[model samples]
Target: MVDVGTTLEMVQASQAGMSALGAGLAVGLTGIGAGIAEMAIGSAAVGATAENRDVFGLVLLLTVIPETIVIFGLVVALLLLF
Candidate 1:
């Protein structure tokens, strides 16, 4: 009983929904990945800083490196949505 136009519209709507889902997944997974990386890096940074005061700056820089991954993911998701 479905007409061609209705079927086409339904397919288009489904595609858009899937695209949104993919964007959400991309951002979510990247955030999780960043968190995991930061967890291990933070522990090491603390240990290094405890041992040597001068290394605190280096450790801080290293700890923030993983943040870029999440930023990139956000950009990708935005691109997908727009």
Candidate 2:
């Protein structure tokens, strides 16, 4: 026979675990999405930079844009954990 207090503790622990899992998923999925986005953009950026040196600045800016997704994910994870 389980006491009410014990059951409540178990529920709280499970909730904490779920929160952690959600936070992990949030960061991992966003990081993966950002990586996929960067893969195509990076390839094109490299090709463009190869053809025109003057376009290197624009290519670099475009290449870095996808990284923002990861940053947003980190923020979400932090929010979840806190």
Candidate 3:
């Protein structure tokens, strides 16, 4: 027969595993999304900057904006883990 304590420990372990998986997915998926977003913006920014050097600063800002999604994802992962 299985011991009750052992069963409880197993359940806790499974829960911990699931939490970790969730955290990993949160960070990984967001990073992927941010990367995709950056790809499009980066290409457009490059084109715009090439056409008008004066817009380089704005282009740079636009390029960096997608990175905020990664930060948000990190926060969510931390929350999930903790």
User: Considering only N, C-alpha and C atoms within 3 Å, which residue pairs clash in candidate 3?
Assistant: none
Task: Please provide TM-scores, in order, for all candidate models, with all chains considered together.
Answer: 0.79, 0.85, 0.83
Residue 45 lDDT in candidate 2: 94
Which structure is stronger by TM-score: 1 or 3?
3
- Which tens-of-lDDT digit does each residue in 2-81 have in candidate 3? 45667777887888888899889988999999999999999999999899999999999999998898899889889988
**TM-score, cand. 2:** 0.85
lDDT of each: 0.89, 0.89, 0.90
Per-candidate RMSD vs. true structure?
3.1, 3.1, 3.2
TM value for model 1: 0.79
Which run of 10 residues does model 2 get worst, by summed lDDT?
Answer: 1-10
lDDT of model number 1: 0.89
Model 3 residue-pair collision total: 0
Candidate 1 structure quality by residue, lDDT tens digits, 3-36:
5667777887887888899889889999999999
